[model samples]
Target: MGGEYELNFSCMLKPYKRVLLKLSGEALMGNLGYGIDPGVVEGIAGEIAEVVALGVQVAVVVGGGNIFRGVKASASGMDRATADYIGMIATVMNSLTLQDSLERNGVQTRVQTAIAMQEVAEPYIRRRAIRHLEKGRVVIFGAGSGNPFFTTDTTAALRAAEIDAEVIFKATKVDGVYDADPQLNPNAKRYQSLTYGHVLAQDLRVMDSTAIALCKENNIPILVFDLTVRGNIRRAVIGESIGTLVGGFCEVS
Candidate 1:
């Protein structure tokens, strides 16, 4: 742990100027089985605040799995399109809650939705979103491309491309990607870095195929790291070799 801290500190020399963070709704659940956990959201907000303090522009795309999962509902016999629309609304709720928490932390924030809801959030405008980040405001994108078929992962990739973020930070429960599920396989190997083709060929599921292909086409690197660890966001932003980097190389440990 001490050595890890040293490495993280030493890598602070080259922080990214702009980044897109992908946070799953389940991550906001903490120990709860469902719904948002205020404490967890507060902790995440604080960490993002630290990154903003470093002058790094941050944009977030949050998932809605905790509140509602469209794919599951669709599998259960509901109309796929309707279920997905409901899922999008769930993401909006999450975005609002996150916005509230971020504002409480004194970090300026903007909630932009692909599906326009004038009463609550601004409509998704690429230029305006970029302007918000340039002015030191954290932008939260919700509603998943304003369509039923696309997942939030795809939305993250799309928004990242539109804003020209330097990198995409995929915050997950696990520390990094592995050859097998570490929980089930004691001998599972963790990958330190991977190439785009490798991820798709192996069906690693780092992100959906659409999202991965989009990032690949846009030439954006993705760093998959453990968000549960305190300060991991800032650590990643500072370029610490702390997660599975998916772009331009392949290595496993």
Candidate 2:
């Protein structure tokens, strides 16, 4: 039995060697209404560890919606730039928490922030981040481009391009991109595949326009999948076709 397990494991082939995982801060919330949930974070870390064991270079871009949402704050009367900066800081916090969970799972990780926070994390250095991934360490990117008015989605696309990742796995609550909100529309259709032009034209909201544009320009495919489903990360890395794929092709099912 042990021999068979080892043989099968060794024969497993992943589709992409290097990839970026975009995780929303809300994912860490799990069943909670706010804040990070330890159980949820640990579960995600375990799955990431499994993928890393497969020799895939992983980079993560985490959002800060759970702790703080800049957009909402701004709409409530706060200065837009100030709210966004606070949101960026919130992302750093989430990144550190994720790094801790990942390390506890025996996966080496580095937290790099766009804003200067050398005391807690390394500054975002593209070459250094790539080098860490090459060395089998997971690199977590925090802060949204170190600028205001940009979502973490854009940061993921930007960082993925900088690190030369082959694909971007966007882990979301929904399983895939839908023509309408599945939560609201019972007949909402999920897209199996999509093209950059279609996504841009239809404004599917898979990611922000800036993010989609960046991915399109860099030719990096973005796979939108449900993070709540355990093992989905590994499934994505192995090309199991569990999500909506956005790239140069278009298909619907």
Predicted structure with the largest TM-score when compared to the true one: 1
Residue-wise lDDT of candidate 2 within 56-175, one digit each (tens)? 999999999999999999999999999999999999999999999999999999999989998999999988998999999999999989999999999999999999998899999999
Candidate 1 lDDT by residue in tens digits, 1-253: 1111112222223579999999999999999999999999999999999999999999999999999999999999999999999999999999999999999999999999999899999999999999999999999999989999999999999999999998899999999989899999999888776777778888999999999999989988788999999999999998877878776322222
lDDT of 2: 0.88
The residue pairs in collision within model 1 are none
TM-score of each: 0.93, 0.92
Q: Which consecutive 10 residues in model 1 have the weakest lDDT in total?
A: 1-10
Q: What's the lDDT for residue 193 in model 1? A: 69
Checking candidate 2 for backbone clashes, the offending pairs are none
Relative to the unseen true structure, what is the C-alpha lDDT of residue 182 in candidate 1, on a scale of 0 to 100?
A: 97
lDDT of each: 0.90, 0.88
